[model samples]
Target: MQLLLIASEVFPFSRTGGLADVMAALPESLVRLGVDVTVLSPWWQSLHGQPTEVWRGSVPHGGRLQPGAVRVGEVRAAGVRYLFLGTPDFERPGLYAEDDVERFLRWGNLVLPTLQSMGLTFDLVHGHDWAAGTVVAHARAAGLRSVYTIHNLQYQGRWNFAEGAAWSGLPAAMLPDAEFYGDLNLMKAGLVFSDHVTTVSPTYAREITTREYGEGLEGVLQARDAAGALTGILNGLDLDRWNPAADPDVLPMTARSGKPANVAALRAEFLLDDAPILSAVSRLVSQKGLDLLVEALPDVTRDWNVVVLGSGDPLLEAALKGWAQHPRVRYVSGMNEALAHRLYAGSDAFCMPSRFEPCGLSQMISMRYGTLPVVRETGGLVDSVPSDVGFRFSGGGAGDLSAALHAARLAWDDRPGWQARVARGMALDFSWEASARRYVDVYRQVLGA
Candidate 1:
């Protein structure tokens, strides 16, 4: 089967968050399942390596044709083709621009025509998040099968109705679904027009049908679910990139043996004493429940050594930096791939207290490195980490997190039980192969093939 996957970001080439990782791995996994897949994404300034121009074209915008170019590239790891839409509007420093809705509308307008120019045909056009939501609408309008995946509902790409209508170049007759409460909501277009809608995890899929997690689109999603057009598929990890056995940075430790050397190395590097180490690798944002962690830090630092890696939200960064002065706590300001691997390998437990996580890769990566995860019982964290493998708390509050952390510490003190838990976590499989097979089934269901 032929497939076209569209997203705003892709890993290794360009990335800002989990969406990039998902786009990078999923297409390759589909290719391994014998599906011919092509990816479409923007040409961000951070994008490494050059892609040769495959086709040049113009998209209709504001009653005029806007010039654009299509550059073809290959992901060597997945053996899948990727095409980048290059326009001056997209040549920015960040993955998202202030005029993201306008930029992506231009991108969506060009997708089908660009494929036609390249003489490429696909059985399905899959759009990821709001950035590519209009692409799904375009595919559906053309009477082609389309799937839309909502990575996060919070970012719906809403704009002023008048401004959107002026810039989008969409037909007048198709305005209802695109407009919500005098604003243009791109996410609504996908949920309303696509053949199918999917989220990263089953829990998240169900959660979005309600007002609490829906971010103002619950009613639309509920209607789609009633129509049998919604699905919840758990995400899979890039096993090759996160494998502990093969990762050069990780200390050589089998499932049977413990990672003492790595633990010692981490303690020495951070100037920490012989205390149970708790680590977190996440962007410091409220969505990640960092506030809860901050509230519980006083009690947490009294017991365990804490290390944090990642940067976001200047206010939260400042708060965490202040806490860094605490003797048992250390904070690194940005993402370091090598350090992340080592930290995962060395830590006794990994913390993820997300208020609403769709499908987190960090908990999975932590497990793969033989570090048990202590997470809030929400979304993918609930699905991936079982009672035997890790600790989970229910309420999204400081007390709840503190209790879970205490339990983890108790588990840590039980050397035999902790080893058993670590072994179970490491033995669990979260590879992309299983996830790809499930996606193949979704495709077949959509095509009736």
Candidate 2:
């Protein structure tokens, strides 16, 4: 099968969240299954390496046309071919902004033409979230099979109605349902036009068909669900990148070879004491339960040392700044891959108290590193972490977060229990093998094979 995967983010190139990790892993897994996979994403200046090729391109669609040709590039990583829609607009540090609508439309218009120029043919075009929704619509209009994966329905690209009409060639009369109050919604376009739709988890699939979690598109999702077009597939983890035993980040072999030297090395780097460390590595956004974690912070710090690594929302940064005076709490307000691995290795426990996680990657990666997770029992958190391997809270509350944290702390107190849980966590197979098979099944279904 020849598959064209379109997403706004991808690992080892561009990363904003778990979507990048998924984009990096899944295509390689598909390729290993003997399928031809190609990825399309925006090229940002913040990207580390040089592209394999660069070319001049022009895109025309919607109401306006970018007649002045722009430069685009291509690269390959992890067995997947990458095509980057490089433009002056993508030179910014951030992937999207107030000016993102125009860029998205330009890329959406160019995607298919770019592939054709490269002499690439695909049996299916799979697009992720709102950024690539218009591409899915174009593919469908061209009589192509498509799969649209809704990573987060909440982030639908909604803007001025005029802008929407200008960005998509779809007539205003055909987009009544796509308009939310006074704005055009990119996610609505995908939900409407794609042949099949998938969210990251089963619970999220059900949740989005409701008024609350639907982000005001419940009726559309309901219609799609009734039509037998909506489904869910839990996101998979790359165990090779997250494994504790084989990880270069976490060393000293094992207890049989040497004491846990990496733990001490990590603590020294973070200026944490020789106590159990509880870490949270995620964006400091409210949806991730940062407020709830803040509520539980005082008690958590009183017992185990806490280290947080993330940057988002001014309010969240201020809250972390307020905790600077705490002797046992250390906060780093940025994303650092090496530092994140250190936290996973040194921390006795990892926390993910998301209010509604679609399919969290942190909990899975932490478990792979033998860092027991204290996650709320929702979405992918429930699917990824086994009960025996980690502690999970049943409901949404500080009470829930605190109780789970306490369980992890208790395990820390009991060395044997902690060791047992660590062993279990390490033993978990989050490899893409099973997820790849499931995706192949979805591909076959799409192809009517």
Candidate 3:
């Protein structure tokens, strides 16, 4: 089956969060399952290499026609075809444009026509997040099967309805479904108009249908769930990218021998003594429950060496900075792929105390690296890590997290048990093959095959 996957960013080409990784891996997995896949993404300036021009077209914007170009590229790692949409609006430095509404509106308007211009036909078009929601809407309106995946509900693209309607070039008749109160919601458009809606995990799928986690779209999500059009498929990890034994960046180690040399290297790197290490690699935002970490720093650092790598939110940065001054604590405020691999390989425990995690890849990566994960019991965290394999806390508070960390530290003291837990986690499969098969099933169901 031919499939078109649309997203704002894709890994190794452009990326900001987990969405890029998902888009990168899922398509490749689908290809391996004998499905023909094509990806559609914006041509961000930061993207490496240039794509060959495939199709040229125009889109409506601000009352006039604006010229648009489509360039075809290939992800060498996945051997999948990807098309880049290029226009003056997409030549910006960052992945997201300052005028996101207008930028994605133009993108949504141009996607279907661009596909037609290239004489490409697909059995299904799957869109990721609010950025590609409008594109899914357009595809569905044109009588094509469409799927929309909500990576994160918190980032719904909402804009003034009147202005959005004008800029989006969507008819006034469709405004009611697209509008939430007085604002135009791109996410709502996707949720309301798409043939099916999916989230990253089953728990998250159920969570978003309620007011607590719905971000004001609970009614819509509940309606979708009632109609049996909502699904919660757990996200998968790219084993090739995350395997500890094969990763060149990480120090050579096996599950049997343990990562002593790497642990020593990490201790030296962080200027810490030989203490049990707890590491975190995540955005320093409230959503990630960094504030809880900050609050529990005093208790956590008293027992274990702490290392954190990430950047986001000024207040959280400041809190992490303060904690970094501690002799047993080290903080690196940016993205580093190599260092991340090293941390995963060397650390005794990994922390992901997210207030709500759709499907956390870090915990999965940590598990693959034979490191125990200490996470809050929410969304995918609860599904991915069993109690015997990792530690989990329930309440979204620092106290609860501190208790869980203490439990992990106690587990660390039991060398045999801890190693057994690590072995179990490593042995568990978080591969994309199963996920790909499920996706194919979804495609078949949508097409009535």
Ranking by lDDT: 3, 1, 2
lDDT of 3 at 385: 92
The model with the greatest TM-score is: 3
Clash count of each predicted structure:
0, 0, 0
**How much lDDT does each candidate structure score?**
0.85, 0.79, 0.86
Positional deviation of residue 92's Cα in model 1 after best superposition, in angstroms = 2.7
Candidate 1 residue lDDT tens string, 231-288: 9999999988887777898777668654888888899989998999999999888789
| Candidate 2 least-lDDT 10 residues | 252-261
TM-score, candidate 1, is 0.96
Number of the top-ranking candidate, with lDDT as the measure: 3
Q: Candidate 2 — which pairs collide?
A: none
TM-score of 3: 0.96
Per-residue lDDT of candidate 2, residues 1-449 (tens digit): 88999999888787889889999899999999999998988887787687865666554442233554455678876687888777666777766578776678666766777666656688999999999887887787778999899998778887788776676666455567567789877788788888889888777788788886787888989998999888888888886777666777667333232225766777787787777878899998878997788888877776788888999988888888799678888888889888898888777788899888888888877766667898887778888888998898888888778878877777788888778878777767778878788778877888899
Task: Point out where model 3 deviates above 4 Å.
Answer: 59-77
Per-model TM-score, in order, reads: 0.96, 0.93, 0.96
In candidate 3 the C-alpha lDDT for residue 273 amounts to: 78
Candidate with the larger TM-score of 1 and 3? 3
Model 3 lowest lDDT segment of ten: 59-68
